[model samples]
Target: MTVQYKFPDNFWWGSAASATQMEGAAHEGGKGENIWDHWYKREPNRFFDGVGPETTSDFYYRYKEDIQRMKEIGHNSFRFSISWARLIPGGEGEVNQEAVNFYNDVINELLKYDIEPFVNLYHFDMPKEQQDKGGFENRDVVALFAEYAKQCFDLFGDRVKMWFTFNEPIVPVEGGYLYDFHYPNIVDAQKAFQVAYHTMLASALAISHFRKLDIKGQIGIILNLTPSYPRSQHPADLKAAHRADLFFNRSFLDPAVLGEFPTELIELLKEYEHLPAYKEEDLTVIKENTVDILGVNYYQPRRVKAKDHVPNPDSPFMPDWFFDNYEMPGRKMNPYRGWEIYEKGIYDIMINLKNNYGNIPSFISENGMGVQDEHRFLKDGRIEDDYRINFIKGHLTWLHKAIEEGCHTKGYHLWTFMDNWSWMNAYKNRYGFYSVNLETQERTAKKSAYWFKEVAENNGF
Candidate 1:
């Protein structure tokens, strides 16, 4: 049976991209080098196909045309990030007037076309200067981050109403410290704990500063929420699911929404003697300030079960110590991105928000698939991305169902608006509705873009 989805009134329909992934003027406008710039210089092959972030989709020079394409696609709102290093060279010393002017121009242009701009402060592009001084491992980085947030508010708050402090805060903890994907690859769980703590403190501090400024816009945090699915009804499976939730979702969810750390997480850290050092007043600050809104990015669910093998004492301690991923047979998958596609996971996330998170007003900040080698879909002047269209429609059906049942979801933003550079994946995966020709700087709307425009115009599918 096919279900029809009609979105709510004035629901935002758009897409999102980060500065580092889209804007390529890395050395222009007095921009300071980010960790990506430094790391790619050291190890070019670390990224896919030796593609660094020096020149992405060229949003820096092509935003004018890009904004026009967004209007053509019926995007009333677009969520993008401002580069901290671009705005302030050397992380915290001086503000770059050129960068400020550039961002102001982008924001004003978006507003001119009636497209609301959602600006995020950080999007995995830590300043190289900050990374050289220990990145998020050092507590001082939190204050430096807060200073950067303050500068952003002073420059763009008047036009930018939606502000996200950080995007997927736990990603750095897992990808950089506990895993070997990102830079400063350390396999220490204790350092991962410290980095996660510093990120939370930075988010809370940004919230506090936003309140002090009395900005007219709303401030929020963007969390990548993965609903954990237990393999069975057994208590062991449930326990494993709990640990996964605590580590990935609640680690950031609790502090940003409830203003307190999760008790189970704290107990686990204490048992391992891996708790991060915290000042006495830090908890008070977190508890006092909570976000005005929340951005939930749901790509997939975590299918977890009780670990069959016991933890080895020789291995470094981490979250995987208690749970193991359970791959169920006959489950639908997005083979293009190699990620599972569970449509109902969107409903589960919304229901959790309504029941446990005080029914806070939220939105689908990012939800889309990344297709490797998408050029196969290219057709006569446009890419026929019917699969991508179907992917979005399936999720929107569930999202609409949740809203009908009283979930406070305001809008839906896809993974991206155009093909841009990713960190490790580089430009390998294409999740955009528009195709960017690297050599020609030409923008062509895909078939999915036309379909999304109709959905946005009618508020339904």
Candidate 2:
């Protein structure tokens, strides 16, 4: 077969899974309770099917087998997050020796298969103990996070070359402070801005620590960027999209890549009295410690339109106050996940980075189709997920174009490797190359896994 969309040589091909999402030893391995464990224990009904993080794919004990499977599937790199609580129980002093051995074994196993380990420091699993101290809201907790990051670097930086300070930093702010979907749920824009600010500050501090360590690796922060597209070229619609972009994308992107916050975002926050309380010294740290790389996770695009009505003065200041989500008529939709399937969004994001953010080194860190009841596509013994194969190909075609057009795009990693317990949604939406039997813990390779193997081996599809 002729290769049509060949990627650059040595491109990374694998998947990403967080500790809380895939490691079933949530309470074992000397692991301390994280906010997820605490939240699930308190509000089990809030999770789908009453499932919690403890029911993950058992990667904690099965990582050796998983690494072998990754080698078979032609993975050159795999991204995984180190459980903060597991490493240092309660996210504080007294490092767990057992946890250190487990991670060292994981890194060694991956290297044995010639797979690069892209380690992420945080993935929304704030230790319950730290949350008691107001989490990132307290500047001392921010210092604690930086200290945790330093420990991770000191422990794993020898083998792990790509380090991410945090994965999707804006997500905790949105889920916990704004929308109330995650743990410690609160709906105050004031606190939301504070969490966002503190999180960015934490990342900068981590990077500062990494540079001081003189580790022979690059460090970055992973951001889930959804390009904000306007409903039309009308100035009002454009303005709405701009605001959404400022609040969602640029809020984190500018700080990580450009070493500063967007001017408009700061001005808007000040206008609404929603600016986060911060020290002047923190700004200098953020400005001086920009990232060396960027990981872009694109699942969908945000279609925005101008707000149709004037906001009441009594209403709280929210992002929705300036814009409304526009459902573009006839937009391609992922029926299973209810997200837009705009493949071009990947290209658009890359171009935006190239034009605006210095074309920093980057990769598609997470992108895949998640379907509910994926067993509906099962044929014989395996899931015949042609939809997933098409989804990846569509995105990669655009990613290839981006690379060809002078964007420094490096690789593509799916959202996951096997069916695992997701937060709140649980296993309702399966986004994996292998469909895992939750009852038996059996991982059956889906059709996409084989197709992905060939694509990875050939450097294209």
Candidate 3:
């Protein structure tokens, strides 16, 4: 029996890309340096094969051709972020007219093809000046970000109807503060907590600004929600998984949608003396300005178990102090990205949002597989990425089930539109419908692109 899987009416069909990852001409068009630019200059060896953001996919010069390709692939919508440093060089002060013109042209081009533009404000490309001023650790940066948001609304709000305050807000905290992957790396739990808090507060402030502007559009935050699974039914294991969820997912999810931090998370932070220095006014802002929409980016599930060994009391406080990652036996895996493949995690996330977060309108903002040595899958001048096709189908099947069960999911956007430069990993893992030739900057559609075009045309598989 061939059972058709159909999405709801007006389900957005497209892919996402970030300015830092897509736009080349890193120093062109009167753009200011961002953390990526600074970090690459300081430690070029840190990035994969010494490839930095200086010359990514050249989206700055190729957006017109890219938009045309998007139209041909049946995309009714597209999502991309504006480079803060590029738009408002130095992260404050007067806007660069060239950057403004570039983005305006991109938005207009998307609209010309009947494609809705989902614009995101921030995507981990912090201005170097802001980073020097303590980045998110300093409360002043919050206001600065709000000002930038207001500028964006004033400039492009009429054409760009869907606005996102931040994409994966917790990622910077995790990568820059907890882990040492991102620039200005510091493994301080206290700083990480402060960064997370300020990001949530900044999101609220942006939402507040958006409402004041009276824009006829939806405003929201994009969160990468990883459903936590316990190793066993033991109380300790269950507690470990729950705490992991609180630390990673709900830390940003709660404030963005529900306008409050989880009680357990607050108590845990307080106990560890890791609570961020926040003013009463910031809390009020968060409480009053919940998101109008939610962008759920699910890539994997977190499997955790209770910590077996007590940490040294003198060591710095960390989320792993309460839980440890558990590797489930016989788990499906994406070896390239080194993440577990759990398709049902998408459905679980949707159900969680529906049941706990007022059933807020949401969408799969980023979901796709990254494969190393993708060229090996090429055949007859086209990449025969059947695995990628199956991956999307698996996740979409679960997403469709969630909708059947009454989850308010509005769309599904793959992690990216085309193969572009990643942060540190560079081009090691390809996760795009169309593969790009880094040497020539030419884009060739993969087998999955044709399959996805048909799926979008049919509204489902």
Cα deviation at 226, candidate 1, in Å, is 0.4
RMSD of 3: 1.0
Clashing pairs in 3: none
Q: Tell me the deviation in Å of residue 26 in model 1.
A: 1.1
Q: What are the lDDT scores of the predictions, listed in order?
A: 0.91, 0.94, 0.94
The residue pairs that clash in candidate 2, if any, are none
Residue 253 of model 1, lDDT score: 96
TM-score of each: 0.98, 0.99, 0.99
> How well is each residue in 167-218 modelled by candidate 2, as lDDT tens digits?
9998999999988899799888999899999999999999999999999999
Q: Which candidate, 1 or 2, would have the higher lDDT against the true structure?
A: 2
